[model samples]
Every structure is written in structure tokens, then in C-alpha cells.
Target: MSEQALTLKQSGVRWLWVAIVIFFADIGIKLWVMDSMGYGWANRIEVLPFFNLLYVHNYGAAFSFLSDQAGWQRWLFTGIAFGVTALLIYWMSRLPAKEKWNNIAYAMIIGGAVGNVFDRVVHGFVVDYLDFFWGSYHWPAFNLADSAICIGAIMIILDGFRSKKLRTSN
Candidate 1:
């Protein structure tokens, strides 16, 4: 980052505090779950008819993709996270200070990425909870970091479509 980029006051980088907050919140929740809860479906705490708090570890990507494979996915996902973080930071540094939505979205992704990456490096897998289910089917267990990333990704996609609409109408 150049001097101009380093001066966060004038760029979307100012929104990094959002990322920091998300990171800590994700980590904190994972810690609480780890300390207070037991692992697996048998130990799950039913919070609602459709939801549960279950402890599990994801050694792979979203929806536990490739989880059954060998251990190499850990390094692959970790590398991808680092690359994405760097790119988002660079993009944020270039954005004007007035751009809040995209900055926030990028920051959120950064936070979630960092949080999961921290888990991967420290625990050799990501800690997961927050199970939503209906009848015999249950969604893959995930944590706060995954939620942030999904929301942020959705926001970015929505913004892209919205920007296109605005530009065409102008």
C-alpha cells in the first residue's frame, strides 16, 4: 500500500473496524461454544423446533465440501483466504471514503476469512455450531464466521446488480 492507501481516513479502509469486530465476535462465540458445549449431534442443545446448537469441526470448505478427502484441503483453503484478504484490503484502500456498503461487505468477508483461518491454523479445523434442521434433514453446521462471509458475499452480489440498474437508468 502506498502513502495514500496508508492514510485510511480518505479510503474505505476506514471500515476495517467492522472487520475487527466481526472477527472478534466470531472467535468469541466459538470459544464460548467450545468451553460450554459438548460435541456432535448426540450432545446438541435444541433451541427451537427447527434449530439446534451443536458442536462440530469442519475440515473443509463451505458445506463441508471435500471434508472426506485427505488433509491437503486445509492448506488450500488457508491459502485462498490469505489471497482474498489481501485483494480485499487492496480494493478497500483504493475506494473513496464515501463508499460504505462495499467497504463494509469487504470488511465482513475479511473478518470471516480471518476468523476461520485462525481456527484452521490453531485447531486444524474450523469450529462449528448453529444447526438448523427440519425433520430428518439438517443443514451443515456452521459458525458466525461463515454467516458473515455469506451475508457479505450476498451484499456484494446485490450491490453489483443494483449498480448496473442505476447506471442503465441514468
Candidate 2:
């Protein structure tokens, strides 16, 4: 293959590796939490004044959106995650190798989505542990996959703004 084609292929492979790393790291952390805590809020390990490691099984989406609904939400979310991850992979494959931010963002999202999907499939719920709080207010519990997805989304938004600025400045 030509040098340019080879470079593009390499870039794609690098992004795939990033995704794999994120997926494994997320899964590893989750497994450790499950093993250590044994599942539930009863045994919380307070790490700091505002943080604690507490196990929570989220049956719904972010913040347990549809957790109260009958068991149908599990399959729905799993299907959505799979669909989104597949679309992101396709998008990443088509994106230009020079678009580093977009590529990284998509890879992170794909990795995180796949990790959560795996949990949903194997455990029937997403295992959450990380918890943050204030004197009288507490943030909803979340896991590494959620963090990755949030970071990836933020990067995508920032990249959009940067691209817009570059276009207008030209």
C-alpha cells in the first residue's frame, strides 16, 4: 500500500487499541469492585470526605432512569448500546486519520459502551461503585464506563467548538 494509505491504517489500528485498553480497564476495575464489595450499599468504603466506594446495581440508564419500569428496560438498553457502539465504530473507520480528537472521542465512547453492554448481558445490570457527595447532597453512583462515556462526549463537544473556530478564523 502507499505511504498515505499505510499511515491511515496505522491510525485506525491505534484507535482500536485505545478502545481495547479502555474496555479492559473499565472491566477490570468493575470486576475488582464486585469481588471486593460483594454487591450492595451496605458495605461502603469511604475513601475521602466526599468520596466512597459503594456497590450499586443500576438496572436502567444514567441515574437509573428507567429502573422502576418492568424488566423490559434491560434489553432495550443493551440493544441501544450495541447499536450505538456499532455506529461509532463505522463512523470512526470513515473519519479522517488527522481528526485526532474525533477519533479518540469515538473510541472512548465505543469502549465504554461495550463495557456496559457486557455488564448488562452478563449481570443483568450495570455494576456501579464510585460515589461522590457533599454535606447534604450526593451525586448518583457511577462506574468507570460512565466516566469514559462522559469524557468522550465532552471531548466531542470541545472538538466541535474548536473546528468551528478554525473554520471561522480561516
Candidate 3:
């Protein structure tokens, strides 16, 4: 089939399954964590020397940016998620199906964004559980949705450096 003739469904949009899977996984894990774990640093469960499943509520964007605000950040973050998802879906529709890296990256962001959006809308915040620490310092707790978004963003950045021209070996 001609690349130009491909419909949305036959294009990289097909990769949205990755988004769906990510969304469900993010939601399911959050639900499980909410039900199975205690809800704060005091209740953290050590999974390794430097890792813990520590349930937390992030009222802001990544790394809890604006978390201490007077509660306006949630709506802002939700709006941003909607915008990002729309843009990603548009990009995916234009991408060729074989462009797995790009498509998957876009889809990952979509999934993760939507998953977090779901949390923000339904729970008034994002549920975070995975925590990494060292000695007396710690990284902000995050969740699977955050991981997917970060990975997708990294993939997009890395793809920018990929060589587009195929070279014949000497």
C-alpha cells in the first residue's frame, strides 16, 4: 500500500494499543496500591536498599511542581494533558506504521497523560507510589504513568539524533 494512501487506522494510530495498555496498567496499579498499601512516607514499604513503594498524592505537575499551591494546579495540569494528548494523537495519525519508535513514543505519552488525567479528575490528585532514595535524600514519589511519560519523552529526544539516511557498508 502507498504510504500516502494509508488511513488513520492503518497508520501509526494502530500503535495506540500501547497507549491503552499503559493507561490500564497505570490505573490498575494505582487502584491496587490504593487498596493494598498505606498512604504516606510513614507507611512506606522497602522493596530494596534504595527503593520503596510509598503512596503519595501529588497535587501538581511533574516532581510535584506547584504542589503547595492553593489548589489551582490540578485544573492547569488537566488542561495541559488534554492539549498534549491531542497533539500526540495528531502526530501519530501522520506517522507511518513502521516508525515504531516515534509512534510508540507518542502513544506512551498519550497513555500516561490520560492516565494521570483520570486520576486528577477523579481523585483530585495523581497517585504516586514508586520511590527512590539514598541515605537521607529521596526522589519525589512517582507512578507508572509518570514512568511512561518520561520514557516516551526520552525516546522522542533520542529519536531526534537518529540518522535518517541509510548508509551502505563499505
lDDT of each: 0.93, 0.86, 0.92
lDDT of 2: 0.86
Q: Decide which is better by TM-score, 1 or 2.
A: 1
- Which residue pairs in candidate 1 have backbone atoms (N, alpha carbon, C) closer than 3 angstroms, thus clashing? none
Report lDDT (Cα) of residue 149, candidate 2. Answer: 93
lDDT of 1 by residue, 1-170 (tens): 78754677798889999999999999999999999998888999989999999889999999998888888999899999999999999999989768999999999999999999999899989999999989989899999999999999999999999999999999
Q: Residue 154: error of model 1 in Å?
A: 0.4
Q: How well does candidate 2 score on lDDT at residue 86?
A: 84
Runs of candidate 1 exceeding 4 Å displacement = 1-6
lDDT of 1: 0.93
Clashes of 3: 0
Ordered list by TM-score, greatest first? 1, 3, 2
lDDT of 3 at 122: 99
Reference-based lDDT, residue 147, model 1: 92
